[model samples]
Target: MSPHSSNDGGFAKAAGAPAPQTIVTDAEGLDAALVTLPGGAPAYVARPGEGDTYPIVLIAQEIFGLHEHIRDIARRFAKLGYLAIAPDYIIGYGDPRTAPDIDAIRAIVVRVPDAETMTIFDEALAFAATKGGDPSRAAVTGFCWGGRIAWLYAAHNPRLRACIPWYGRLDGARTKAQSRWPIDIATALKVPTLALYGGADPSIPLELVEAMRTRLKEAHAPAEFIVYDGAPHAFFADYRESYREEAAKDAWARALAFLRARGAG
Candidate 1:
């Protein structure tokens, strides 16, 4: 086990949690599972059943943690011939999945240190190598809370080929655990990044998104931002009421194109 992993426990079912999406990707042609990594980190791993090797995609989960939506995303990546791994980095503090409300989930989220998260991702990469993943061909995509993480990870790990963050926060309070936001790291990004945002997201205003864009441009970072005019936060989360199919599909397609162009797909 890696020294960085936390073996607190697995995810707990949240009371009154919304039902999963009905259009989830299946494992018909994929090898997928909820497995324990070498460091004892829990993760949902998915890959093409017939492939000996594939590009790797490290998926970051929303505040809800490694729920059905995240797992489904992994399957979708696998179907596209990528080895997708979604590690449960927050299980140590407590299962955010079990939180009954947004505030309850935030309590668990703030405790997760950004430094520790980078290590967990490192472990995920190690595990991916053993599962026929091409370490040199790796990309990351995240949603909600994970979307913010995707931006940080891109800045932290230069080896990543690309990063795609779906409606991640651009600015926020600086806590010891989470000292930086997407906007703070814009100048430090080394990998090509594609950030998606909802124009109607009350949590992340347009001005902040533009501020991030300005920083990235000043730093000459290879980055792009796509804002859906009327989409709400979590537009890609089909299981949530905020899901916007048109925007989600468009974003997903653009993400794939960006990854491929950046040598990750």
Candidate 2:
């Protein structure tokens, strides 16, 4: 979805958000393209131009779905020598990329069941293995809408070496499609996770972040939560006004280190 699109009823882009600063990555050297997953879903795959095998990183997209920003994220991981695959996990709810507004995006999001998405991830990993991806050395990271799913995927997939979720929701009302939140899985998390949050994010309260932190500590889960003071939600989204260069750069460094430390690098 175009964050600058005015058709979103003012929900697509935050109010007073800085003028859109879309950053597009040139795919001049990387092997990047739109490929079909084993399950027939469309996905963006990016990797080094010449690699016998590379670590796998599955990128989860924002509520806007598989847009250019998300594709750029995959390319970023590819630059770090990863076989990054960003699948269109938001299937069956229509295309959020072209959705007229946030309400339309939200409607499709609420209907996406975790079970289906997890299964799609399973397929995506299998697809990766065919493209010189080492499944044993794999990680998962997501932004905004995908961020929350990253938490669940870390718990669901034991093979993942690391997980990093950026500004994902910690707690929320449960539904048939979404029966669990990050807080609900904190105590059971099995993979090393580095979670980044915006201290000023109005949608996600600091209290929930603290609660999740407490739960992880109590369970001795391998996870770290970092809050960037005064940073707004989606601070890593450079295309939007919420982007904070300092927080985003620091978080990116921490994410790469976390993944590499756990052998996903």
Candidate 3:
């Protein structure tokens, strides 16, 4: 494991105690479990509200692994009447939380092959099925690095009903295993997707977003991108400095509506 500091640039320390806002109420019955990935790595799983079959929405983590914020996201979805699960796709890699700085996190992320991440997602889908999730109605959503994975997963899994990628980078220098960009697969998507982005995000320029839109239009993919004018990256993360409540709320409403339209709920 990489030597991690409790304080890092992109990653935050895990919450020591629950926050007072009360985003999810019926979360008592939900238990966290560990599932073995295809490569025998252990990944965390959070079950649905009442342990009943519900349409599943696979939650992907940010550069940070399954931290408190990501876990809360799963519970928040359960409160919305859907089964949401997030797996630790970076299980074999060093824990991002333990990394001493953002550079360490970035190094770990770069070393993680896209193919291996996708395989873990497939295992997450199988794990979701055991928790009473309807695989046929499964959808996927992700933030930051996870957002890029959301797009890749949509292309990889034809069974997906919908997808939402939040503030993920649209373009980057291609690696061997990460040859395909989102634009490359935009038109080949079988599932509908909604991409939420921040117009002010320097990491992901608006021009790239526009290029992705053009590709989606050309391919006739059921995909849409929304940019919040002044919001920066990670605007939806309330615990972070980039939180934009109004924009986050609006984007979340759109995401829920999009999922419901495609039968994810």
Candidate 4:
């Protein structure tokens, strides 16, 4: 409900991460709050003061869950005149921000079933509809762990106008829970997506990007993949050392254009 608290939850500052942004706590015009889903799931929401009804963009969080960086992303979308929501989709595994190490976070996160996560997204959309968010003008975009989910959600939600998946893994070993990788679902994507990726992300090899690119082309999916030279994973996260200002700025422009082109503007 209040501005994001980096100290309370979130990984310890990564080396060379920019100092966290200061919140103008008393500022008006934009309001951010928490909302509970039908089955008691929690989500962070931000909206502009001037809109009676606005385009909606759901921002899926990175592996860090609803950390300050993720909250800032939702706020960014809201300031752009959207009803932006970021659901802590990592429910039931305990707060990711509370995990002591990255491996610990992954151990719990990897156990979440895709079916449950997808259902939560549907619940999120229903929640958005109640808050002046127009379902017809809906868009979804996400980073890291969330970026991959954006791809899956695009396939699952026919109503989404656009999707942007930023730096999520393209191929991975399948488990019972995460049965479909991006490559497996490329042909099924239902809307336009501006796929932003880092050419140099070690965790996500360029081979996988190219593979996904080829699959999208073969399937004639309405999506475009653009890789930023020399950038690495989590490049849009200014609060991390991996942030690349040039790539991040360019991706932001493309994301706005992609969503606005479809209706999320």
Once superposed on the true structure, which residue ranges of model 2 sit more than 4 Å away at CA? 1-20
Local distance difference test, per candidate? Answer: 0.85, 0.85, 0.78, 0.82
From the highest lDDT down, the ranking of the candidates is: 1, 2, 4, 3
On the 0 to 100 scale, the lDDT of residue 226 in model 1 is: 95
Residue 155 of model 1 has an lDDT of 87
The sequence of per-residue lDDT tens digits that candidate 2 reaches over residues 7-79 is 1112233223334665666565688877777677888888888768999999988898887678878878888
Q: Which stretches of candidate 3 lie over 4 Å from their true place?
A: 1-26, 49-51
lDDT of 4 by residue, 42-89 (tens): 888888867689899988888878776777777778888898888878
lDDT of 3 by residue, 1-265 (tens): 1111131122344322333432432355564444566667565555543647888889888887777677667767876767677877775777886766677878878777889888888988887787788998899999999999999999999889999999987778798867766777888987889999999999999889999999899888888899999999988876666778899999999999998999998
TM-score of candidate 3 versus the correct structure, residues matched by position: 0.88
Task: Tell me how far the alpha carbon of residue 54 in candidate 4 is from the true structure, in angstroms, after superposition.
Answer: 0.6
| Candidate 1, 91-159: lDDT as tens digits | 888888777777888899999999988888889988998989999999988999999999998888999
Index of the highest-lDDT prediction: 1
Model 3: lowest-lDDT 10 consecutive positions: 1-10
The predictions' CA RMSDs to the true structure, in order, are 4.3, 4.8, 5.2, 2.7
Model 4 TM-score (2 dp) = 0.92
